[model samples]
Target chain A: MTRARALLIVPLAVFVGIVVLLYSGFGLGRADLHPSALIDKPFPDFELPTLAGEPPRRSRDDLVGEVRLVNVWATWCPTCAAEHDELARITGETGIGIVGVNYKDDPNAARAWLAERGDPYLFHIIDARGDLGVDLGVYGAPETFIVDAAGVIRFKQVGAVTADTWRDSMAPVVASLQAAAP
Target chain B: MTGRTVLGITALCIAATLASAASLVDAYDFDNPALEARYRTLIAELRCPKCLNVNIAGSDAPIASDLRRAVRRMLEEGRSDQEILAHLQDRYGDFILYNPPLSPATVLLWATPAILVLVGLLVLRRLGSRRDAVELTEDERARLDALGAEDP
Candidate 1:
C-alpha cells in the first residue's frame, strides 16, 4: 500500500478497534461498574467515632438488634446538604433509627453542618478517614444502607436519602425486617 | 547532493514534520473565579471516555476537550455544579462521572467483571482437563523426539 493509504488505514483500524472494544464492554462506562443491588447481604464491618462534641461512637454492637438506616455523608458533599431535610423528616416519622457515617469529613465542619441543618442521625459515626466507607464500597455520598436487626444489609440507596426514597424504597425494607422475628 | 547531504536533508525533513505534527497547548481562561474553580473541580471529577482514568480537566484528548467546553458553557449559563453534572450524566450516561450513579444499568456492569472471572475460571478448568487428557500419543512423542534430534 502507498504511505498515505497505509496512514489512513492505521487510524481507521484503531477507530474500529475502539468501537469493538466499547461494544464488548471494555469501555462500558464507570456507571456500569456499580454494585448497588446487593441490598440483602450482611452489612460490612465498620468502626468510627461520633463527632467530638457529641456522644462517643455507638459501635457496630449498638447497630445490631434493630433495623437501622446507615447514611454515609460528608459536609463537603453537595448532595448531602440537599438530602438533610429529607433525612430529618424520615427520622421524625419512621422512628427507624437513622445512623450516620460521616465519611472522610472534618469533625468540626460536620458538627456545624448538623447544627445548622439539624442532626437527624440517632448517633453519628465519624468515618473521618473514609476507611469504613471503603468497606461499604461507598464511591460517594449521600448513600444510605439499611441493616436489619440481625445486621444483614437489606437495602442500599446510592444517592441522596430523600423522603420519597425513604418512604417508597427504604421504609418497606425496614418494615419487613421489623416484622421478621430474630 | 552527496549521500551524507541527502541523509542530512532527510533528517531535517523528518524533524520539520515532527515539529508540525506536535499538538498545540491550550491556556486556561477563567472569567469568573468561583465558576472557574467549580468548573475545574467538576471536570476533575468527570472521567474522560478516551482516557478513562484521566479526568477531562487533566486530559488533552479531543473528547476531554469537548467535555471541558461543555462544562464551561454550562457554568457560563449559571448552572450549579450539580446541574452541570446532571446534564452531562443525562447526555453521556453515568459513565461520565468517575463515580457512576448507582442505578439498575450500573448494577449489571459492576457484577459482570466478577461473572467474567468466574466464567474464565470454569473455561480454564475445562481446557486444563482436556489438555491433560490429550497428552501426546507414543507415536507423536517419538516423532517429536526425532524432530528435536534433527534440529540439533
Candidate 2:
C-alpha cells in the first residue's frame, strides 16, 4: 500500500482498537464496584466488643461451624437504615445467622438504632474505630459477606442487601452452603 | 454597616479551615520528622477507597481516616514501606495504591501510550523520509509533454 494509505489505516486501526477496549470495560455489567480481596478466603479474624454493653465479645472463632452472614453497618450510614427491614425479613424468614459489625458508629446510637428498628443480628460486633472493617476490606457500610461452615467467605455483597439480592445471591449461596455442611 | 464584623468573621473562617487541614496531618505526630514526612508521602500515595478520586491524605472519609491510622500504626511498629503497602494491598487489592504495580491485568494500561507514541513517530519518520512531493523535475515534465503529443 502507498505510504499515505498505510498512514490512514494506522489512524483508523488505533481508533477502532480504543473503541473496543472501552466497550469491553463495561462488560462487568453492574456487578458491585469494588473488587473484593476477601472473596473465597476466610473472613478476617477479629474480636470486637459487643454493642450491648461490652461484656459479650464476638470473634471470628464464634462464627465457625456454621454458614452465616457478616454484615457491616453503622447508624451513620443511611443505606444501612434503608436495608434494615430487608435484613430483618431475611433473618426472620431464613434461619441463616447474621453477625453485625457496627462500623465506626457510636455505641449508644447504634444500640438505639438497632433497638428502634428491631435488631436482626445474632450478635453485634461493635467496631467503633473501623479496624475490623478495614481488615474485612470494607470501604463502605452495608457490605455483607457469606461465610461457609469452615469460616471461608463464599460470597460478598458490596452494597445494601435488598430482597432481590437476598433472593438472587445470598439465599441461594446460604442454602447450598448449609446443605453442603452437616 | 457591619463591614468590620464580616471581615473579622471571614478571617476567622479562613484560619479555621487552615487549622482543620493542618490538623489532619498533625493529629498523628511521628517520633521523628523523617517518619512524619514518610507518613505524609505514604498517605498521598494511597487512595481513599470510599472517596473515589481523592488520595487518603486529602480525603475526610472515615475509611480514609481509618487507613491513615493503620498506616501510622504500621510505621510506628518499624514495618518497612513494602510491608505496609503489601498489607493494604492484601486487604484492598491494587485499588488502594495510586500507582499500581505492572501486572498482566494492567499491561494495556502501562503500554498503550508507549505503543501510540511509537506509531506516531514511525508515521512522522515515514512522512519525513519521502520528501514533499518531489517537485516534478524539468526532464520529467518534458517527457510527459512528448508522451502527450504522441497520444494527441
Candidate 3:
C-alpha cells in the first residue's frame, strides 16, 4: 500500500480500537460499579451503635485478628435483602466473621428486618447518620469489604455479594487474606 | 385551563426548590472567607461517589451529605485545602476529583483530544495535497485519449 493510503487507515484503525475499548470499558464498569475507595487501606475507624441491644456500639477494632467481611446494608435496600441468604450461607458454611453496617437505616426497622430474616452478621453496627458509610467510601447498601487481621481493608465487593460473587471473587481473596492474617 | 394547571405546577416546583434550598444550608461556620471559599471549591470539585457524575454540593445521596459534613469538619479543624482533598481522594480514588491531576494514569485522558486534532490536521493536509494530483504523463494522456476514441 502507498504511504498515503497506509496513513489514512491509521485514524480509522484508532477509531475502531477506541470503540472496542469503550465497549469493554462500559462492560467492566457495569460489572464493578463504584469500587469502594478504601481498598488496600485500613478500615475507617467508626464507633457505631450495634443493631442488638446491650452492647450499643461496634468499631473497626472489633474486626481485627482475622479476615472478616464488613458488609454495608440497610433495611431500605432490596439488594441487601436479596443478598441476605447468600450472606447467611457464607457465614454458615465458612464460619467467617461478617460485620454488618446498618447504613442510614431506622434502628427499629433494621432490628425487625434482621430478626425476620436471620441476622448473618457477627455483630451489626448502626450507621444511622451514615457517617461510617461516607468514611468507608460506601457507594450504597450491600457492599462487602474484606478486612485482614490487622484492620487493613484488603478487598471491596461493590454490589451484592451473591453466591456467584462469593464463589468467584470474595472466596479467592478471602483465602489469600486468611493465609496472610497474623 | 391547561395554562392555569401549568402555572400551578410551576409555582409548586418553585416552592419545592426553595424548601430544599433552605434544607441544604450548611450547619458549619467558617473561620474566615478564605476558608469558606476553599470549602466551596473543594465540594464543587469533589464528585459525589454515590451520584451520577454530580458534585457533592449538588448530590443528595447520603454519602454526599456526609462528605459535605466531613469537608466542613476538616476545614474547621484547620486542615489545609490540599490535605482535605488528598484525604478524600485517597479514600475515594482519583475519580473523586473533578479536575484530576496530570499523572501517568490520566496521560491518555489529557492527550486524546490533542492527538485527535493532530490526526485531523494530518488527514486534512493529506487531502489538501492530494487535490494537487501529479500531472499525467503525455504518453499516459495519449493512451487514455486512444482508449476513449475506441470506446466511443
Candidate 4:
C-alpha cells in the first residue's frame, strides 16, 4: 500500500513476532539467577560419622569461627584425582587447612586416597552416606567452600581446586575473612 | 499423505506421549514434601551428561532416575542444599550445572548473551534510523501529492 502504511505494518509485524517468540520461550532475555548462584551463602548442615571411626571430626560447629577451606572430594572422582596434588601443595605449603569431605567413597578407597597422596587436611570427614555432602550443596567431588570465621560462606568453588585459582580468587577471600573477623 | 508418512507421524506422536510417563515413573518415593522439593531442585540442576539435552530432573534414563533417588535419600538424611549440590558437582564437573559458575572456561558462555543482545540492539537502531531518514522518491511524492489534493 502507501509508504506510511508499509512503515507502520513492518514495525507492527516485528513487534508481534517478538511477542510470539517470547511466549514460545525463544526470547533473548537473560535470567541471571540459576541453581549454582547459591555460592557465598551459609553452608548446609550435617553431622556424619568420621572416617576410620575416629569420631566425628567436623560438624556445623567446625565451620563456625574460622576461615577454612572445605574441600568436598571422593576417591572415585577423576577430577578429584587430578586436583589432589594441587590441593596438597596449597594446604601444606600455604598453611591453609583444607577440610576434606570424603563423599560417598568406600572407606577403604578413602583411606587409600589419603595414604597415596598424603593427608593435607587437618581432619577428614567421611560422607560415605553422602549426607554431609548434600548438606553443603555438593553436587560432586572436588567442590570447595571458603567459610569465614563467623560461619558465613565467602565463596563456593564448584570444580577441582587449583594452585593458581587458590592464589588468585581464594586468597583474597581469605584475607577478607580475616579482616572481617574481630 | 502416503501410508508410510501417516505411520511415521503416528510413531512420532507415540514416542512423544511415552516420554512423560517414563520420566514420572522413574522418580522414587519421597513421602515427605520437603525431601521431594529438595530432590527436584537437585535433579533440575544436574545435567544428564549422557542425554545432553535433558536435565536429570526431566530425563528417563535409568542412571538419572537413580541419581534422583539418591538425592532424595540425602535430603531425608538431613543434608543441606549446598551439601547435596556439592555431592553432585563432585561426581560430575561444573557441566552438571545448566549454568556453570563464572570460571575462565565458562566466562564466555555467561558473557556472550549480554554482549550479543547489546550488539543486536545497536544494529536494529541503526537500521531503523536509516529507514526513518530516507526521503520519498519523486514518483511516490507525486502520487502522495495527488492523493493529498484529492483528499481535500
- Identify the candidate with maximal TM-score: 2
Question: In CAPRI terms, where does candidate 1 land?
Answer: incorrect
DockQ of 4: 0.06
lDDT of 3: 0.83
| Superposition-based RMSD of candidate 4 using all C-alpha atoms, in angstroms | 10.5
The fnat of each candidate, in order, is 0.00, 0.68, 0.56, 0.00
lDDT of 2 at B53: 85
Mind giving the per-residue lDDT tens digits that candidate 4 earns over A1-182?
58768777887898999889779875542221123434656766767667756764557786577788888888888999888889878877767767778887798888887888788786877877655554554555677888777666677777777778878988888887778788
Rank by TM-score, highest first: 2, 3, 4, 1
Q: TM-score of chain B, candidate 2?
A: 0.72
Q: What is the iRMS for every candidate structure?
A: 11.8, 1.4, 2.2, 7.5
Candidates 1 and 4: which is better by lDDT? 1
How do the predictions measure up, each by TM-score?
0.48, 0.79, 0.77, 0.55
User: Could you give candidate 1's per-residue lDDT for residues A42-94 as a string of tens digits?
Assistant: 67666566775455655778788888888888888999899888888887887
Identify the runs in model 3 with alpha carbons over 4 angstroms from their true place: A1-28, A31-36, B1-28, B120-152
Looking at candidate 4 chain B, the ten consecutive residues that score lowest on lDDT are B20-29
After superposition on all CA atoms, how large is the RMSD of candidate 3? 7.6
- Model 2's alpha-carbon lDDT is 0.85
What's the CA error at residue A102 for candidate 1, in Å? 0.7
> Which clashing pairs does model 1 show?
none
For this target, which candidate reaches the highest DockQ against the unseen true structure?
A: 2
